[model samples]
Target: MATLFLGLNANAARMDMVDVSNNNGYMSAAEYVSMRNEFGVKAVTVKISEGGTYKDPYAASNIANVQAAGLYVNGYHFARYATKAQAIAEADFAGQTAKAAGLPVGAVLATDVESQEANNQSKATNDRNNAAFMKEIQKFGYRADVYTSGSWANNKMTIKGKTGWIAAYPYVVSGKNWYSSNHAWQWSSTAKFRISYGGFDVSQLNSDYYTAGQKSKVKPTNKAAVKANNQKANKNTSKLVASAKWVKETKTYTLKTAVKLHTGASTSSSVITTLPAGTTVKTDQVIIQGGYRWARQPRFNGYGYLATGPASNTLEYVKSGATHTYYTVKYGDSWWTIAQRNGLSMTTLASQNGKSIYTTIYPGQRLVVR
Candidate 1:
């Protein structure tokens, strides 16, 4: 097992931990060793469950690997409940899944409540639901925390004295006093690391955040690792960029249903505002992320992404003009050929109507072309 050592620069805040989910895929013990030795990571939290039914497939391996690499291992659940009953059920699922995934007793188990439905609820309701969840998860002998954005941590729900894990990504991450109210702050989702596709979600934890036993087992750090860690934490190498695919053509679209506009393409991105149904706007690009098709609409200072519809289909939420044009499938027609003939990319053509390049289109079947 890996052990965390004291930092060389005592004044600089430590980027204490990194959290992972199925989105990050599988990581080996060797990979975690790199995270510890190279990046000075002290702990890891694996996503264990979501809602009441879904369990993250990667949780078990991740938990075992983190322990094998000698890093403190904990678990978190993606919450989807709005009512007390649902919260209890979800909490039970999270606890069971965490135990099954090898998370030891007395480790922290967190509830990640960032869904649009949960965020839209009244504060009283959210407070009640969060309380119910935290209370229920403690039955399994794990400490609990509510994981949310810094804004939600401050404004939306009460933590009931349990230390909260708050996330707020600013363009630049520096200083010792960022997000001082919470026990832990997830400062960067795009933190530079050798693991994963894009970047790791790096967090700074209070010195006492981990259990006493976990902290007691710490090993001493060498000079090189401590120096590298401080430099990276104070000034990360990567800059935040909008994750969207721009297109050459700009088109007008009318919203078929009300949808939230996000600062970025993913649903997990911060919500800017909600646009009502029948809203019309010109979009310069389309981003297919998190199973959704987000249209880049003009905003005051920059652009916001409106989730027009599922990546499989956008016609349900938006149309190009007063009405949409469709084409009937005929003999020998293919998605690529049809898209080429209509001057559209096969990806856009298929995604516009909730179909894929592999979707079977028989003669007389209709497809949205415009």
Candidate 2:
């Protein structure tokens, strides 16, 4: 499930914004509110810096206004020089701001690691410094999350036990998927908005706000617990066997050779394997090794090995009569697709079919096309 997340950088008063010469640099209270309402944004993250010349003049009031409008609020800090002392100061500033604004629901502190100063620390050093800062902030009774680009988070930083606010715009990278134990994802640097500010246009900032939901749905704190539970649940299960015999549904499957294996039962597990189709296996043996469950061999010969190539077949003309219509199941389709195809909402479809969207549907399931 994808949850909408909205991020507002209250550090428009910062020098970087001023230097960008964009109208989004400085915004007024009214403009901010209008933008939030227009975007249906649920959260706003204000920026606090340690020693930056630019400061948010209305940080407190901005946060209050956002919360008053019923949006969740959080605070961030630009780690100038990326030192333990600097991080501590930045964390202190963030804590003070959060306390002043009464933001209690969302994450409290974020380390903005980007800097132009010569004193800016290396990735590892900055990561450690930010971690130190977060540790101190945690002492002040607030949860801290790290804000960095996808590359930095995956390749450079190494701060454990902290949630991540990944910045991966345009097309979200594999590393940007927050489902891998991070808390939130920043999908875009430009998002659409309706607001104007002090000689600055809040609308200009809209371009940087496109992002996708996390791929992995597990929360950071509970990941370990969930993994442990899952491991325990599958402890006795050992190798997954075929629930039913399935033949090659695609041309990629070969005969007799040992193909790649998957551990999980779903398509997500399929991604981690190098398995080919059509390989003959034992009736109750696991065929693939993937994340969650193993692929069980299909029950019958033709049903299991029927090769369906990856090519998409476009059935342009369906029977005009209400009796024999055709529908296509897409990559992201579930019961949701069937409902949408019939011009019905999820609730209506659920009530009519007596089934939830979570109910599994297989390919070629005869659904109402009319």
Candidate 3:
């Protein structure tokens, strides 16, 4: 079938496209759902591994949520291995996972490859590997497509007969463009739309442009199935929370206390409660406040008491001798200034301090003034 170019303006149709690669930081299942609902994402592409090695966490839940939303869903795998056997194995893994999850009809299986130096024999080998992978997926009775950059398609990969999902962001290349002959063209990287879950800015691409025969086969029964699917999905989501890593360590305190307290400006003023010595708070919950923003705590619920007037900026101090009188440097503390005030020399002071003449000292840094 000939390739189709779904123009950028056509994105008003409310299609949400999600890139589920491992590179895009970790997102919890709840976060994924929130993002989907917030951004109105209509489709999610779960990224499986290249060599059929690893699957992401909450994969089942993510798929379930997408299915419940009555949106199109698909899978893509990074093609790290350029050999036919490796590609086939990766395809097998994707096919099994997709079939198991009962992905909706008209969904696609995609291969994502980019410009990278690899042990693959040649560009032809990469092409052969992708073709082999697609063939494996076809064995399981599903359609497969290739996703590649425009430059890569023109310079490296060749797609003559196979359906290609071209990534030609920024602008639609000319009709004779490398990716123009693709089954679907990713025209814009920033396409805005709304979904039932929420609204989001998605990329402009022909997500799944079905041929006449394929389009006819898929009946629009998704709307009717949404409510029932969502009920089951909510149950699955609850199960996901149980498996989630939500220890107290993850809770963060924005404000010191739920209510703000006033502090009197005096040395004996008990403005803030000191944490017990050796009391260890979770790394995730405790955030170090500094600078101008330190005056107020973060705005959140259930935080403890507020801290007043920069509680001992330094956390630890080394006790030296009977007393440790740390002195701050005054203005005009040059070699001449030191000699006139403390009777020290330019060379002697520089050598004793292990500093050059050009060293720029700060206001509060302690030095051996005596």
* TM-score winner: 1
What RMSD does model 1 have? 11.4
Runs off by more than 4 Å, candidate 1:
1-13, 160-162, 195-197, 216-295, 298-370
Identify the leading candidate in terms of lDDT: 1
TM-score of 2: 0.41
| Candidate 3 vs. true structure, TM-score | 0.44
User: How do the residues 8-103 of candidate 2 rate in per-residue lDDT, one tens digit apiece?
Assistant: 222111101110011123234454455444433434566544343435555666566555644445666655645677667767776775576564
User: lDDT of all predictions, in order shown?
Assistant: 0.72, 0.41, 0.45
Better of 2 and 3 by lDDT: 3
- Candidate 2 or 1, higher TM-score: 1
Q: Rank the candidates by TM-score, best first.
A: 1, 3, 2
In model 1, the number of clashes is: 4
